[model samples]
Target: MGLPLLMLASGSAALAAPAAAANDETCRPTIESPWVRAAPPGAKSLAAYLVLRNGCGTAVEVVDVESLDFGTPMIHRTVEEGGVSRMRPAGKLVLAPGESLRFEPGGLHLMLMQPLRPLAEGDVARVRLVLADGRRLFAQFPVRRSAP
Candidate 1:
């Protein structure tokens, strides 16, 4: 049997945290400091950020992400071309062994679109990342009033 899928949502003061270990030893990615920006009223989308750390001896690829709070969750990156800033799809993120990747403002992030409901500060959103090795990692991202 496989590990159960985790559902993380916020209503209380304490946020949900992801598991520190994986069911299989070959793949273990630790997620830390997950958070979503508090969207303005009627806003259509928001960005989520976190740190992904590979603790295994091999590389791991994060192929996709899913969330129940939004209609779609896509990996995205902010780019500047000809002095114009734009957002683009980031196909996949590969992490080398013992590597840590940070998703922050003005960099790689998760584009959460078509929110099922409005989000505010202190709200928690549930997100799951799909890996190339067929492993799913769950995380809880808190909605913050400002970027951390």
Candidate 2:
């Protein structure tokens, strides 16, 4: 009985060790040069752009995004269909090993709609991004008057 119990405990610990390591040293994705596109007065919707660089050995995917400034901050991509450009939810943004993804106009971006309050220059918006492995990356995106 004692031998079996010891073996069981050892096996359980072995299984949990990797999971703990994965959580401890997971990928870190940084958002750089984050800015919101300048919107016209009375406009209810805006878009934010940034560059996401993965600084980890393993690849990571951005599965979700959230912000209090917008009704719903969603990952979006612009596509041209039938000579009309439309923006649609990206659902998820995946990055390969040591890869960087850029979000800008006519490309992947954040759709910020129905601003709770007016978003003006110098207003830094707090944003949260959830990775596929349940890790949350945060960034304070500065509200700018134009896209750079």
Candidate 2 vs. true structure, TM-score? 0.85
Once fitted onto the true fold, the runs of candidate 1 whose alpha carbons sit more than 4 angstroms away are 1-27
What would the per-residue lDDT of candidate 2 be over residues 1-148, giving only the tens digit for each residue? 9999999999999999987877774448788888887677677888899999987777788998888777878889999999999998886678987899999989899888788778777777778888888888788888888765
Best by lDDT: 1
Please, what are the lDDT tens digits per residue for candidate 1 over residues 104-141? Answer: 99989999998998888899999998988788889999
Candidate 1 clash figure, as a count: 0
lDDT score at residue 59, model 2, on the 0-100 scale: 78
Colliding pairs, model 2: none
Error of 1 at 58 (Å): 1.1
Q: Provide the lowest-lDDT 10-residue window in model 2.
A: 20-29
Whose TM-score is greatest here? 2
